[model samples]
Target: MNLTGWIVYNGYLPGTKFRDFAEWIQRAAANQGIRTTIYKNNHLLSCLTSDSVGLVDTETRPDFVVFLDKDIYLARQLELMGIRVFNHAEAIAASDDKIASYQVLAAHNFPVPKTVIAPKAFYNTGADTIDDYQKAVQLLGFPLIVKEAFGSFGEQVHLIHNQQELTDTIQQLQGRSFMMQEFIASSYGQDKRLHIVGNKVVAAMRRHSASDFRSNITTGGTMEAYQPTQEEERLAIATAKVIGADFAGVDLLIGPDGTPIICEINSNAHIRNLFDCTGINAADAMMAYIQQEMRHNHGRLADLP
Candidate 1:
């Protein structure tokens, strides 16, 4: 497949890790004979004028884009320009918002921990009425998990053990978007991550954190190669498709009955950790999927019968 594209990641993110992701994807594209240019999202300013959306760019637009950031407007702008973006903008938005992701998953009848979305409120404005919070706490019970709608690496998730604790936690959040979920005790310090690409589970790993209730690698979790059960694999694949992801890192929690439940879905899941743990390069799979899709969409798939 002959294609030109752009790989965009956040430029202000202060770390070599994200840039490293872009480079790895670029290398994969190169191996497939696809030419790509890397761009920090900020490098291409999104221009908005009366009746038109465009990017301030002097260079010619590419055939497609591999967007690794959550700049939804920019992704939409690219779509408006007829540039295909991997993991479509709508999907990214759903995945970026924890509340939205759960709503979709529940609508599809997937198994998820009991969850309650906090009502919209301002930071300093008092949620003075603990009445609503009390009802939610009663339904979810103590030791429930309070998670911000928008967060990564388990940093925004907190384990609340009591009514007062819950109130304190919310107060600390200062009106940020958050939700409450039933704590999966069986999966307290360990969870499984299955990376899927184009309907296939490309890699799987178990992440464990002895020191924390959260099992995120960024939060002191350790990784080890693990094989997913058939049910686990099925759930992961279904989840990626349900969320409309080209590729995703689906986190699964162990239900009390030992069944897999969706912990989260990441549209822009970092591949470096998966690579280090499973030795599988998801970028390769991602690039291959993109190429096949691009060619098929352009009526260039050689396998057409």
Candidate 2:
């Protein structure tokens, strides 16, 4: 077998985004002469029995998997079965949750905006069990960001201008995990994206919006190919390395001084937008990285077991 693999994407999600991601990788794999099959995550059941772990009543396993969905248990199970997974389960877990990500970044001494994670509050818990959230205001001040910990495309992010909005946001987000962060006014309507593969940036872009504070391309923001500064490149690569992502799209916001600040890291970032703006196929870089790491050209999957 010449590096047979599976590219798995979420099945429940509508639209073509997930399918497109898989196709891109498949095309790149074909160029490398490696065969890869596209699979919907649900089609491959995460099998668990009394004494063994695998996909339940499934087809023959591949040598490796490029997982595009946030299925931590399924990913971990694959690893247990002697298959290599790029941007492994732990990387996805850390990147998927905003609160967890910030905690890790802060612990590693990365430059992130001042943020405060809300404490655990359940539906059954009384309001008295939760803090008044005056602490978040005191720490982050006015015009801050109230972002849900597990959202994408900036849909669940909010800008709170004062105490009233902060209180209302917390009340609305009650029983959910979220964070309060300092809003970088300078970065409003603009940010940078760097696609990192194996400790280096393969493609970069600047996303800008005229009417919104968040500069996410999926949310109607515009983009242009960008040449990252030496410092920006270093920071992006370092951020990806810290989370152990084999490939990632790292988003950075401009600080007041025009320096870069870590906004977030995306373990399974879509490459289509970057391709449209930069004419760079990050999928190629991804396949190449996988080949190098697996030593596929050398004809072995020794890294897995």
Candidate 3:
């Protein structure tokens, strides 16, 4: 069976790490004999228009759509058309929103840090008066993290240590919906990222950055192979299940008390690091998974006929 892969993102400009990784994924898929296609965000939008626009042609519609940086809005439309999409739209939307992700994980009894959600308007106004400042403090104490609702690769995360810093940061973030979470100093310098595909933990790594607090490899962090404890694995799996992602990268922070708290669940996880560090053929596994799903679906259709 022929399988088509799509990388959903805006056009990758040269010299960006994301572009490099995207190309690597494409090459890996090619080596596995999968016909891959890259569709940018604007291309997907243009696909819906009457101009017959976008990279996806009606005649060449793919069997599976692997969204890289694509929006979650296309889930239902594609699902109804019998396309197998990795990380369905609902899962993507939920995981993309930090507040929503935390809520889902917490509801499922997954350990996450104390978090507070604020409207963009409230945060933009800046808490000048003591009462306003107190309100903000009451929600999340000092040494907190402020993050935009939707961002990737650790681009929109900020750490605030005091009232003045907090105030200044808030003022700077005007007009953005953000979430605040209590910072766990214990996890200040290190964290583990577990890459899960289907029900298996294919590869894992621990990231540490001397110059940055965020352990995202894309953000100048150093990566090493990680073999997590049984407890950590369990927590990572639970977090993945809650997010409903077939492929996920679960970030777990070690709290002061040695508890592993779920920080974030990435639906469209980067597989390059896992491949580079652990020698796991994650792209091949992903392609195989898609082929299996396609065969299963085809069988179901035949039975119906």
Candidate 4:
């Protein structure tokens, strides 16, 4: 009954409520008699084990790896090693890149915002500007969002209302990769945060912030208990499956048309706000699920093919 738990880092760093939530999960797992390991660096090479039944890393590797990052690159490496990574690499990769995420979700009939990937050349400074920005606006429309290809905690997400803002932001992000997406107007100020574990919707909350444009609690948003509608629950599960995440925090924004658009899918979701506001103990639930999966896999290994 030995369980090895690895956290990306401590949950006490500045503006990282999710990190705090990870710590809470670690504590809760300890209370349940599970062994845990916390990694301060965002590297997976140091955490692999030859005999451990399970391994959790914010990055990817072989040997029972559980990835906690939104990036999919690590998942692919782990998958290549024949390890079972939650949120398979392909799914994480697709979700990490906004343009790719929207394409995959749309292909599968998932509701996602209209999005377009700006050419890398556009940010080159020496490339033609009008054509690139025009293409972006044509595909994604005005009042758009420009997000760094890989970012989290709502840090690199931006809302651009007009051409001036878009130009300024693009210039500021010069030489960096980014994606442009149509801002869901109805989701202007609020959205639902759904936390999923295994295949079930474990805890859900409605997030709102008067002072910030983002609903992430790390961005100063307030959270309250929310009972997801049937459609919302289905969308959350579908998004998780599509993204290949065993556990995830799915952000669903209600469009002006009252449709829920998948704004973001967080592989390493924070549980502190949900726990504090809803009393759901998502950390405990996740630990239990991981342990159960480990046991199930170990049993199968004993039988061999």
Candidate 5:
């Protein structure tokens, strides 16, 4: 009656962090009597042939897949073959791109910082095709935030204090997808990360940095276990739902007036930091949720071989 699944991650990424994420999920699944195999994205092939479309040499398909990497194409390919994919491919893609995620949030009336997506072009389209700097400056004012659409751990986020800083940063990011956002000065060096499973916030933590504008734990910030306010919980859960995430790490910034505002949504959030800060194993909660999803879909753990 044990469930079977595959925890897929990007093998191309350096260091043990990526592999470690898969391993943690594997162990958590094991704790719930679910058997899971870890696979690198390169370990499988998504074959397209006139006669058939499938993954090459995939003998037995698992009941579901836990995608820990941002391999959207592979995730979609797996879905095409009839295997259930957690978080879903589209959700991953949306969360992977800051502009896309922000658009979704804005459409849903979620409270996200004011953001302006840069124009698309192979080369820096120059000021001719891009938004007028004066207009952007007027909207967001000085000391705004600039974020590359595709980045992680606050590495690609920059704080621009004036027009020259914005210009230089944009020049360096030519041909890249990015956005300019309103700076939340009150939460400059602090934010809350809430891990959501199903429709509830399971574990929460507050991260703060003494020397930087970003408070991401991966960027030398300190974290402490936190109890989320009702508004914070509501915003986090809503973000996950709108993004179609089964589980996610939702960052909330404290507004100047103490209101909760979404900073970012991570579809494949690393749970180790959350566990370290709160003593709650989000992986365990995710596994349990996956089991319930299977059951709700009329599939039983006994169906696995």
Candidate 6:
């Protein structure tokens, strides 16, 4: 029997970008003869009762979900209903929070920049205390990076060159979870994005910006096809595995001596840019991986308790 899948994306996000991502995945699955449906995350209402977990989607149930949304609750809800979700909800939640992602990487002995997570602030509590700021400064030093735990497209990332700048940024991001990290001057305006599918690197690219510290394409950076060294490839694959992602975009920074250090892992990374840069359709690889997994585990996933 043919398998069906649901590509779930955020419904409330403005613009076509989020929806576009789902479509790309859907098309890739269609190319392989897998029937796929696009569902807005909000359309699937997660329902819970004292003794039951259920989701209300008017459409037919799918055998699996290609979850492209950051709505962790919705993802988990679908999982509870016995449908497999690629990139898993827990992985998505961890990847969505920069601090959580860093902690997971560090725990697994992955090479990462020195990082110090800010103390959680109560809501409407105003600015953070100066002592906490001083602690982070002492740990990470000046010219460090201040990044909100939950942000994307490098928009919430700030470069702090002094105590004043650090403190100012902290105040500006009051009541939000964030972190400070050592700046890798060697990778100031460039980084590599490796798209890992299953156990291997399917595509890679170098993103660089002449005018910005971040190399994210959303920030006007340019992309070029990249060849990953063995070390870079291993790090990318290991990081993705440790984070429990079936597929991921792992960003790597060059350390002082040219060693690769992980910058971040993106669980719901879009496939369009990787396709444009490397001429490799990551969505195709993802769909193929899913089909292989389903076949290998045929008549077994339903038996999973």
* Reference-based lDDT, each prediction: 0.91, 0.90, 0.76, 0.74, 0.91, 0.90
Please give, for residues 1-305, the per-residue lDDT of candidate 2 as tens digits: 46899999999999998999999999999999999999998998887889988888786998899999998888898999988999799999999998899999999999999998887767534344225677778888889998899989999999989776766677778899988899999999999999999988999999999999999987889999999999999999999999889999999999999999999999999999999999999999999999887776345534555
Per-residue lDDT of model 1, residues 1-305, tens digit only: 47999999999989798899999999999999999999999998877799877788545989899999999988888888778999799989999999999999999999999999998877656555456688888888988999999999999999998878887888777578889999999999999999999999999999999999999998999999999999999999999899888888899999999999999999999999999998999999999999989988888546578
Better of 2 and 4 by TM-score: 2
Error at 260, model 5, angstroms: 0.7
Error of 3 at 132 (Å): 3.7
Query: How big is the positional error of residue 305 in model 1, measured in Å on the Cα after superposition?
Result: 18
Among all windows of ten consecutive residues in candidate 6, which has the lowest summed lDDT? Answer: 123-132
Per-residue lDDT tens digits for candidate 4, residues 144-248, read 898887788789999998888888888777787877888877776689999999889999999898876688777888889999999999999899888677788
Each prediction's Cα RMSD? 2.2, 2.2, 3.1, 4.7, 2.7, 1.8
Q: In model 5, which regions exceed 4 Å deviation?
A: 124-131, 299-305
- Write down the TM-score of every candidate: 0.96, 0.95, 0.86, 0.81, 0.95, 0.96
Q: Candidate 2: global Cα-lDDT?
A: 0.90
| Model 6 lDDT on a 0 to 1 scale | 0.90
C-alpha RMSD in Å of predicted model 1 compared with the true structure = 2.2
- Model 2, residue 161: distance off in Å is 0.6
lDDT of 4 at 111: 81
RMSD of 5: 2.7
Give lDDT tens digits, candidate 3, residues 1-305: 66677766546444565565567667767877887887665555424556433335546677777766546666546655666778787778888888889888878777888877765464445545334456768777888898888888889998888888877766777677777788988888689998877777778888998887788877888889988888888778777777778778899998999989888988878777787888886777766666677788888988994
| Residue 62 CA displacement from its true place in model 3, Å | 1.4
Candidate scoring better on TM-score of 1 and 4: 1
- Candidate 4 contains a number of clashing pairs equal to 4
